[model samples]
Target: CELSSNASVSPGNFILHPSCDYDGLIPSVVFFLSFLLGVPGNIAVIIFRPNFQHLSSVSQKLMLNLVVSDLLCLLTLPLWIYAFLYMWTFGLVACKLLTFFVYCSTYGSGLTVTVLSVQRYLLVVHQKNWTHQMGVRLLLVLLWLFSIILSIPQLVFRQVTTLQNKTLCQSQYSSQAQRITVLLVEGLVGFTIFFLVVFSYTRLQKKVKQAAFFNNPQTTRLVTCIITSVFIFWVPYHFFDVLSAAAIFLNNEDLLQFCLTALYTVKALHAVNSCLNPLLYAFTSHNLCCKKSLSPKI
Candidate 1:
């Protein structure tokens, strides 16, 4: 949502929400907890391994990239909390730069995860020759670069706005048309990446059934964890997004209000995915791997 309006001449007229106190507190709490978990969890992943230097698998590297991005995203969350709790004290430049970093990190996390799945599918099912590809180091660099480029819009478009004498930090897209454009781009890009992931897995599943690794329950659980959360979290948000787009396109006043409210809740639920992934997918796999590594030799 557009946080505040930056039109200097008419500073106090752009308040998007009615109650800043309530709005500020709720998200501040949520994002604070997220930052707490994300920062330490990711750092420990790197630090806890004894042979961290030697450990280099395609999947592991991708996961590392994911954690790094999540950490970056979490770091910026405090700025949001600060804005809500106090005021837009950082001014416009800090607001846009901080928000841009957050968006970049977000895309990095999503894309890294998606690519990890594809990598797993390839290794497990296709048995393709992955060698001579410059390995995980190159891929990690590419992931960050891709994330930065994709998040360029957020950097270029976001700004601080003042409404009703309160300053808010948010991305600026003036009209419904612009909002739709951003939403559509996000939906299309996300769908395309996810579609590839799904398709690759579908083809891989048939082969997995015939492979020895498929017999491992952990493998099954990992696949299930990623796909289930992605669908469950993203689908509702997108459903509401499509509805919002429809209302805008159709000029349905009543539906727009109803859908926008619903969209707010759905988007909140979608953000929960960030926190849930670490607990459900990452921690579980870490536990499983540790168990196997510690098991007695036959």
Candidate 2:
């Protein structure tokens, strides 16, 4: 969903029922809490990175990168909250920049999680080869570049427009084809990455079962947490995006309205993923205090 327009639309214009206020209010509270929690949690992940001696591993590095992505997304929450409560006063430049960063960080986080799952699968199911670690830094650079490329559509399409004398920032598609194209790209990319992650984790799980590797419960727990967290936060958001795209393609106003209503709730859930990652790290790694010398397993 386009964060600015979908979220900042006046309740009077969109709310069909009296209870619609609850829908908006609850998710607004969720976004607020997510911002309060996510910022410090991701910061802690960076400040207290694992202290492995061998430059750590791909998974460790990916975790740090994941935090960076989440933090970038979270930094825009204050603006989001402001827009949700009032209106988008940030103008066109800030609007485009914020939306661009959100998309970049979102795509980055998804790719990072997918790659982390792949790294874990390899480590768990196959013999670790030095080549797996080769070009780790370069891979990260490419991932961010890819994320930027994925986000280019947002920068190109988003605009600041005045509505009812209220200035707002939102995506302004010139054509139905353009809208569907962007939505399809976003949904497909997210689903593709998540599908890979799920496949890798499924294989890893089967391997763990066959190998009876329950002796190290922490490893299994960590994998479960990562997979579950990513899936829970992202799947619904992408699902709604796909549905919204279909609604637009079909010119189904009812379905479009339903998708928009659901978007706010799912968007908040999606943002909560950032806040949950650090807690997942703490619980899975047994490093709640951040000073522990535990080897990074995820």
Candidate 3:
């Protein structure tokens, strides 16, 4: 896919490439904001309070994992911003490794959220804990394993490709079928996580309103924001993937073009998602994450 810009390219004029203006500027700014806000917030969550790593509560542990994942996603923003304004000067290995980190962080975030929701459902509605810390620890370990395995394709396929005389970091699949398969898999997995979260939250709604821990208005608001933010920020990013896969499958060039042009914008929205978690889970969840009476224990 080619980067679209406002400046018209005359015939055989490959030097006039896309700049930081037009399509590039928006995502770069979004990435910058996400980094500026997300890094400090996540760091505060980890170190602001005492014994952060020694958290025993299942929710707290999962929330920490989520914070770490967002930080992983946020840390890559400087490299991305530079790539957007100039080029990917970090070479082939950096492209693969950096992109791999992004994939792992994203999958880890979604999976952590899924498991956290399930843990809450059991506690609030079923009156059951995870039984032992070992179980939760093992479960988190498995999630990371799965995330890395799923991200292998990125490590294998992403490269620094010179497009329109600009060195850009992008994925290059062997065929349309390969590209479609990867896109479909990522979209399906994301939706499955989304569906599970929705299901758990739906089950918790009535119970939570009556439950002691969820009685705190701040707790209730935090839960609602957590659920709503996932949909608002991530749905479109995945939606574009599904549509892009369909466009390639149908050989619809126009639809593929539209998807390509708009996909970066959706990715910026996804970045915005990572930045807001600090506010939702850390700053605003003083009642839920910090309070002994409100935060349910394992």
- Scored by TM-score, the top model is 3
Model 1, backbone clash pairs (residues 3+ apart or across chains), number? 5
Clashing pairs in 3: none
TM-score of each: 0.77, 0.83, 0.86
lDDT for each residue of candidate 3 in 1-298, tens digit (9 for 90 to 100): 3554211111101112253435567778888898898888788888774333333467677888989998888898888887777777899998788878888888888888888778767766676767677887898899999999988887776767776677766777777788888878887887888888878867866565665544457666767787898887667667777987888889887787676666655677657777887676556544433334433452
Worst 10 residues of 1 by lDDT: 6-15
Scored by lDDT, the top model is 3
Candidate 2 lDDT over 1-298, as tens digits, reads 2223332211111111112224356666877898899998888878876432323366567878888888888887777766665666777888777778887888888888787767766655664433456599889999999999988876786777765444666677778787777777777887888788878877876665554325346556666776787778777777877888888778887777777667655667657887787676432443211111321243
lDDT of each residue in 1-66, candidate 1, tens digit only? 322222211110111242346654555676678767767776776576323333225555666677
Candidate 3 Cα misplacement greater than 4 A, ranges: 1-21, 50-56, 211-220, 284-298
Clashing pairs in 1: 4-161, 5-161, 5-162, 12-164, 15-163
Better of 1 and 2 by TM-score: 2
Quantify all predictions' global Cα lDDT against the true fold: 0.57, 0.66, 0.70
Local lDDT at 153 for model 2: 76
Off by over 4 Å in 1: 1-20, 49-56, 133-138, 202-205, 268-271, 278-298
Report model 1's TM-score to 2 decimal places: 0.77
